[model samples]
Target: MARFNHNKHHSSTTKLVFLISCAGLLGAALIADFLWASSSSAAPAYLSIASSWALEKSGILVVQNVTHNIAHHKREDVKDRKERIPERFLPATFADLPAPELQWEEMPSAPVPRLDGAAIQIKNLLYVFAGYGTLDYVHSHVDIYNFTSNTWGGRFDMPKEMGHSHLGVVTDGRYIYVVSGQYGPQCRGPTARTFVLDTETKKWRSMLPLPAPRYAPATQLWRGRLHVMGGSKENRHTPGLEHWSIAVKDGKALEKQWRTETPIPRGGPHRACVVVNDQLFVIGGQEGDFMAKPGSPIFKCSRRLEVVYADVYMLDDEKKWKVLPPMPKPNSHIECAWVIVNNSIIITGGTTEKHPVNKRMILVGEVFKFHLDSLTWSVIGKLPFRVKTTLAGFWDGWLYFTSGQRDRGPDNPQPRKVIGDMWRTKLRL
Candidate 1:
């Protein structure tokens, strides 16, 4: 054991001596290098250059472009980084925001002039139904205009030829549903007709009848349900105070049941009620008749003050109704086209407030837009022609303005030359 311990000590001594020897050799080599460098410092600088030139002649060393190399590297680094986007590609400034572009085109005329009717498009076909027709008479005929062929081909006559029948008609791409409307020229009490037409078979059937017959009410399809609201209770044009809805399971599978949604707080008559982006918006209509009542022949522009509504009401997330910002102008005698162009809810053309002294009415042909993001309304543009009491629908970024009664200058009630003129406006993209 003692011998083994001595051998281990001897091995350690050997390793230590070898390390010291290696360090001494490295120090000697470094000293020699220093001496050589010191000697070369005294040599002519041109000798080093001459050696480089000789190497280049022999092609052993190559000359580099130092300036060009540095610049190229810097350029590559900048190239790899992102470039600032061009002005044309940059985010839109206030001045660069899109301006409204509207154009109107006349198409083939309807066989009969329609007022206070509904226009719904199924596929490429447009169906125009019940309204006061020729001679201010009420009639029932489903006029079908096909845009695909650019012609009026087929027709469906209503079972009972009654006019002013329904305030609105809605479709779920397959079936067109017509609800209660006025009966005759007098625009008397509403009818109980819940007419459903099948576009596929070109046949009509009755769904469950409207609980109470009423006309001029705003009706639309919301979340697969038929939503009806804010229309005349009396054929004399009293706006109803309540709103209602019935579930339509699919496009055509409507449950024969009605459910109360919410009572409108104000302005039921002549308001445009529409569902855009799942939000319900009702805008601009007559609030109350000024010094007017039943059994009176001159039911307009009385000595008493009138109330035209500029208020806007909206239905919300919790199945409740509330007021959004009011419209800027007071407009009554509603019946104009409300169209949704992408994110903008556009209301165009309506009868305006009556003059205070002259009692002459104003007709509005201006267009207003409600932007969903900003939650505000602004005037985008005006219609090319002053028109009102029109039926409108949007398809493929185009707004189809159907037959509507035009505004006559300074007349008490615009004389009924309800037009059969068809015009189309499309946003230029």
Candidate 2:
């Protein structure tokens, strides 16, 4: 009986050694499978069924052997992995939602012809103030679109022509504020002019000027103050992060104050900015003179790409700038087409570098909706028209944008013709 037992033990040892050898060979194949799967080289050929089965068998073997031999080690590895990840790496917005499900509805038209100005939404009314039109400079032109009525009407013209305004218009739920629009002989340049129009009075009053001149920047309401971001100054490029705050009485501007807050790390003209829950987001604009430092001539279009930044930036509660993941592709010339839906942002069409470079710029009608929580972007349906450098607003489950310039440029030797067309979009999510 002792002899038989000894032989049996030896046989069992031999079987164990043979299994270990097979496991090692399978492990090598498994490693090769992972490497090949993750390769960035030219696309790899599809794995054969036999090879796939072999890989699966090897994975099972490895997992089973590790589970049996190093259960404690696996537990420690998971713990270490959890500890190593930064909190920010986890989903921040919408608690890591996948994508936003939203719908859009179209609006009728804006009452007047305005371009390169600013837009603000108050209650059921959208007030577009002080923009250029078929005429070179028309300041003090205020057009109001009523959401409830699907109509447009307001003070048609101001005393002065406001030209090349920063589009830095904002609202406090009542009056619409227009600040630092260009006027006078330098209608095409920046101006320190500012104004506020009372919805009740339907009249415009000159308010304090901006500390510096700005043209076609972005403005929003945050922390009970109207915050403006990004635009150009007179004869100088302003990729500004300088934040200005204006005090408002129940959405009515009563006084103004300016603060040179953190400048945008990356700045450009015609960028689109919007705020969601007090967090400011800036996206899509022409990268002008951003590379220029003091004493150096600005390089306007150096690092040109077909599309540039699909990335979105967030200025969170900490007042620190965080680079969220970028969009799938970079786009520019996105005016104010940014709108919020289901806590996410919808970024519509803008001119790509291909457009300006090839002189084939179109008013893009495509929409890219970004999910704040999931850090993902999905391409929604396209708009009916190619709208760029236009004013867009969201109200009553619909989007309204108007007064963008569309032109036959160097192609026809004809100067750019500013468009006075208004478009409404309805998203079906």
Candidate 3:
């Protein structure tokens, strides 16, 4: 054999430079092949074949490159939600879940018509607490529905004069904790009227008052604590994002020292909030962070701020509020109702904004179900009727909601009926 060109005079550095150049050329070829295969309409087998032959020694590295490419493609797909068909990928309720045998059942009506009430189920009993009545009157009517009997039980009025509608109420089976709500003749409050009812004893007693008066707010119990979130403090216009919490022993409160946690990014006059898997979900809410340039009359005079949000937010265990995917459009459903069941969060009813400036305004009857794991939303179905300002709760296996309002509106010019009928949808989720 001809004498090998083994040049002892060539330093190690020269060898390194030559090796690097060879490696770079190989890398450039691999990249070009990858791009050509990806961009071209026809699939080419040359890249894999060449890579396998040339980079055989660095097979592990080649595998890593493939993995990285896959990960990058997945990230791109995730960013574009429109590319996802949630129904094909996610279950309406639970993952890998079979189709639900769902049915709707009509139940006994409330003795009187009411609206803006809070609904909660303690064991087998569904309680419809204080709400606004006909003639724009505040109601203390407390109605109980027995799922076992499929009938309405004896009606009970509130112990004291119940406040205006949109009060937050949560129960730990034994006690019903009613938080701040509105009252007064002008429908003007955001009152600190806090009351607790011994469900077993049927006795209502005053408990720790709310830190501030809030109206049209939402509350949920997470890990033996009550999380109160979002509502107007002064008026419906002054939406609040502040959140407060207090610990409880079993169902009863253990101590009274309530602490405020990380507030929500935006606040709205009407927002629905709930806790699932230690995450707080706020939906169909709005945020009015507008200010009138410091000293303008709009600022000094406290002019109404108009803002509506179709975005949804979740507060996690780290106390961080994360913005989830927004509604299909930007119209804020002014009075929507939401409930968490199985593997999804479903929001229903509520009309869109009417103002011209809020162009997304559209009366919504579509029910959207958000699959928790996939982080995707699907229009599972629509409401039978356009329902707004309705209270929703989960009892047994049914989602109890409103029927048709017999006209809960103006009785003079047009008789807007109040939907006093109780309807429950049984789900085998």
Candidate 4:
């Protein structure tokens, strides 16, 4: 029943071949359309290709392999593009920045040479209070420095009754509180007078006096109260253990009588007192003090009897004094030579113990950092020269100090060069 029809067979074969060609062209057109759609829209390349293949009923394995190859090539292209970009044009982070260099700059000198003075910074103005000037005379005027102008603004008279040296000074931004100190030159007896100065009005007002006068008391303001503790008593050689507080608000004493608190474990003067996070810290002082000749006129004093100590103490929330790690060495005459930076306290320029071999007074020149969190101390840097009674301040990441007594030489027993030269250094952390 096989009939030989060559023409019919050829026609059927040609039709079959034509159908195969059309199917191949249709698959190619589908791929082209999907690629164009992916380029012009947000649809993913692999997703577009998969949709096109699903409609064509292509092999699942073939679709996956081709899509994976395309994805791989796209990843490579992105990597190449990133490599073409410059590093500086990219976004930066704090870690990428360089550390600040430690460089010191000398600024305009203060109006008058001062030692044992008190300085407080309010906004852009620095107010320097009474201190020992040239020829052992007391400076009764307040010197001001305008940081914006880099020049001494002028001088204003301090209260005539205000003590000239060994004053306990503190500030609450707008007001400066001056506590008990030696009323005049040499080793004069301490005064019980307390004064407050309104920096805005440039006026001084007397407050309720201290129960007992003190020399270089460790004074600070904390928890709406003015605290005074640890200083030389009426007998300049005796260290007082008395601790007192007065309720104060808006620069005025809210209470009449000074209330007694727990006395400091180590009672002495010339200590750095600071209030941080509601905690009070007392650092560095001496047991004995410079005393005047029994009946000498001008009350000439001798420093030979003093015994410097590196003791540190802190008053806690429970109002109990807790002993802290002492300084690297004995330091004194640094009542105002400390500044808080971040979680650390930076101290510079103070009087240390006398030289062991020569028995000469040694001045501290190293800048010290005390980390409150770690309870550790580190020598961060050195000062241009050894000094004491330096008034330290911090502003805009810079540490500054103005007036102090500079060391004459390593062998000199006493610091005879009092300076008003100001110096500042940039700080990082």
In terms of lDDT, the best-performing candidate is: 4
* lDDT, candidate 4, 173-274, per-residue tens: 889999989888777888999999999888889999999999999999989999999999998879999999999988899887999999999888999999
What do the candidate models score in CA lDDT, each in turn?
0.64, 0.58, 0.61, 0.80
lDDT of 2 by residue, 122-205 (tens): 777766766655443455566777778778775566646344445566666566667674553223456766666677876767
* RMSD of each candidate relative to the true structure: 29.1, 17.3, 19.0, 24.8
Ranking by TM-score: 4, 1, 3, 2
Model 3, runs deviating above 4 Å = 1-105, 250-252, 287-306, 329-336, 355-363, 395-397, 403-415, 426-429
Clashing pairs in 1: 164-182, 165-181, 166-181
Question: Per-residue alpha-carbon lDDT of model 1 for 44-139, expressed as tens digits?
Answer: 222445655655565443233233223211222454334422111111110112335566778788877876677776667777887777433766
Question: Scored by Cα lDDT, where does model 2 land?
Answer: 0.58
Query: Which wins on lDDT, candidate 1 or candidate 2?
Result: 1
C-alpha lDDT of residue 17 in model 1: 100
Kindly provide the TM-score of model 3 when superposed on the true structure, using C-alpha atoms.
0.64
Better model by TM-score: candidate 1 vs candidate 3: 1
Which of candidates 1 and 2 reaches a greater TM-score? Answer: 1
In terms of TM-score, how similar is model 2 to the real structure?
Answer: 0.62
Per-residue accuracy of model 3 over 295-363 as CA lDDT, tens digit each: 443222233445666778887778898888876543343332667788787766554443232232234
- How far off is residue 429 in model 4, in Å? 2.4
> Which candidate comes out best when scored by TM-score?
4
What TM-score, computed on C-alpha atoms, does each candidate reach?
0.67, 0.62, 0.64, 0.74
